[model samples]
Target: MSNPLQLEVERLLALGRTPEALAAGEAMASDWARQGQPLRALALCRVLLQLEPAHTRTPQLLADLYARPDAPAKGAPPAAAATLPRVPLFSQLGREPFMALLGALELRTFKAGQNLITEGEPGRSMFALADGQVDVVRLLEGGERRTLASMGEGEFFGEIALVSESPRLASVVATRHTVALELIRTRLERIALRYPAVGETVRTFYRERLLANVLRSNPVFTTLPPEQRQALARCFELRLVDAGTVIIEQGQKGDGLYLLLQGQCTPVLRHPDGKQSAFSSLREGDVFGEISLLLGQPASATVRAETPCHLLRLGRDAFEQNLASQPRVRAALMRLGTERLLHISKLLSGRAALEGDLRV
Candidate 1:
């Protein structure tokens, strides 16, 4: 008899119904399964799985079909069906909803005491723990060293270097039989495109983590979880200035915004009357130049460092470009802008009310 299931799959594909074709293909595979035709079933299963990694039932059914006897007889063993990295957490994450997109991630094994990453070294890839344990350690002067933390299965590391674009913070060493899924930067960039939300989610997650880790140390982001605060931080770049540095002039075109991340500074606002007034003192977390950056106007004030300072500066072009790329960031900034306008309206209403009371 002609294979009715295969006929159905062909008809669906002919009609350009990819979803239905996949479904029909799966049913045909199942029919093959019932007849113990493992090889035939697995062949059909392969095509379906590739088209729809998120197709819920197909992965499990394919797993079952591949596990059946004679499935491996016709072809090399399926790569997906291979025993997952035996190290701690690799197998568990492979079952996650997003693992299919992590196709670029590769399983890597290392012997105990192997260095996963070294401090002060450049990094090209990040790793997620699949099995065993690794230690975050730092070597100090005088040959002293300290263990900062121990990470095990399902834990991820090396993300700081990748996300922050910085050198590795600390050395990582496998303390036992270890396995991990190494995610390369190129693959991550592709993931960022295919699943931009994944990158946004990851960025938000990392921002919060960094906030908590460096809040006390970095003044630029002390106000946690506030859209305005985060935007002000992200919309700028850090610049180091010596104690004698002149940051701004009293009357010049303001091309950027600035946020003080470290050290001390003084603000001097010059009036049209040829008089200067001390506007405010600046310290860590304080922001300035935003008035011009936001208004597209000239500088109304001068800024000079009282001491060596680290300042985050964001030029208009860079700020606008970044906002154009990240929708979430643009949304956050819009919300902040709305809030500020509303706040100013409320203040004006209160002042008008006070003026009426005096008139009365």
Candidate 2:
């Protein structure tokens, strides 16, 4: 006898339509459950769950399958021990400290399609996935929602906001019925005070994550070795500039490289005649002041914050002392500085030509 749902799933897989195949598999699993074939349904659900861990329906279906009378007995450890090692966020923590941290966490459940965190909202807690999956999405300029990444069991999010005290960067939505362990900032603070090891562990993880994010987002830093990137990232000092604040003045000697972590800045060129021309705008993840850093000269333009900005500044002394050994980073910075100088020269030449035409 032919099973229509199974055939449909197979057809979708053959056509390389994985999303559709997973959906078809879910339907087939449902059919098997309805027909009182618990073991078969459990097998199909497990396969679908593996394929799309974020699918909200699959986990619940699997749980239901497990609850069936025919399901085999399983010896699972106490919940905390069973789940703690699974979370990558805390996997590096010593077993004793992790167990203590695990004891401090509060488990929460969210239904399918529920938002665990929303972009731009203040967040004071971090979440570690215990079961099911979530989709991390960013709201784009055009009002479109883009899925940044899908997270499954053992993964985590919200730590950046918690550590930096910044608003959430992206929205996290449950793809299915999900379970997560929430570690609130206040509770974590208390834990850190009681156990210094816990605090150190958290800080280490935070620094590593921040470095990885910065290096991953910027193409210029991607070629450098991971250890070098970590070293460079650690040397940065976070500075906040309010709107209308001048971060760098034209003709002032550059002291460091400023990487914009948040908000915007406009670079303005002031001519000898004192006429100021706004030449370029920089936003998050953009870097500036590299030209002066490379040349040991005064800043070429003034950069003013258009909005309140958060920046990671790597001072000259730190760069020379820590990052000087990394040839790839040095070469990349030199190339970047050369390109910017050429661009500025062209712009100046064009303006000169325009002024000459005006006088004629």
Candidate 3:
């Protein structure tokens, strides 16, 4: 509440400018949404919606707040709220959301050597460990078991069930007598409908974790130091694009560097003969638009989503501030662009040779 936007909202309220205060508060809510403070964003959104129900951005804002992800949840940043800090999954929820979930949670007990969740079964709920220990295991394709992780008190698992009807990806077994709090998907989603800010909170946590994981594993980013990688992750904006969307146009300046998170994309170069040919396809974990962004030139190829795509974009201004300002990171990006360009050139040369033969 002490941030510039919060302060502005407070000052406007003090002056009895209720309409203006609500307006500024809405903007502050957006800041919270983007900064991994979803509960705060949700609380503010709820407040503004109540005050100005006709706000043009309500439906879309709420939809996005529920669906989109952002930077890592820092356990309530400046837009922080008083919330449960036990399970990292629900640790960032606002007071109302925490209370709503509290009512829906059921305490469950499991004896040692018992299954809490069996892999391949329908995932009906997610659980937060209240006491004791458990093991997370996955069934390998060869019929062997692989222990993925060990969970102790305050840890939670099986969250994807809350958002999707997907089957459980892994199994949880109690290593000892365990006490846990379970929230069924039916109940949890009821809260989502009632308080979409809760949706925003969950969305925030997901993106925060996802962005961190993606950056940590990205090929180019892996070369950067951990601290630098984290810094770069914070600057990225995750975007969703529909199939057939042209993200980068041939011969046009790229708006930013993009890292695909989901779906498929193709980079195609148009020849002088009014024909378009794909140079390569991009999939999850692939990076694009860097060559143009790094070299300060127009895009040499057009990149379009061949399937619905989720991507992380780092804008030019953000790049200048975080990546370009650091010599090592800048050089790494430059090297990547050079390597990709060389590959594209070879692909083009091969294509041209084939086309020339056909002309003969």
Q: Provide C-alpha RMSD values for all models, in order.
A: 17.6, 12.7, 15.1
Top candidate (lDDT):
2
Stretch of 10 with least lDDT, candidate 3: 351-360
> Clashing pairs in model 1?
87-131, 88-130, 88-131, 89-130, 89-131, 90-130, 237-313
lDDT of 2 by residue, 33-96 (tens): 5554433444454456446655646445433333322222254222323221123444455544
Model 1 RMSD in Å is 17.6
Ranking by TM-score: 2, 3, 1
Q: Regarding lDDT, does 2 or 3 come out ahead?
A: 2
TM-score of each: 0.40, 0.64, 0.58
Over the full model, what C-alpha lDDT does candidate 2 score relative to the true structure? 0.67
lDDT values, one for every candidate: 0.56, 0.67, 0.66
lDDT of 2 at 175: 90
Q: Candidate 3, residues 164-200: lDDT per residue as tens digits?
A: 5556768999997776667788887789999888877
lDDT by residue (180-250, candidate 1, tens digit) is: 66767667667767656556545544444343344334333343355644554455454668887879875
Off by over 4 Å in 3: 1-86, 106-189, 192-196, 223-231, 274-276, 351-360
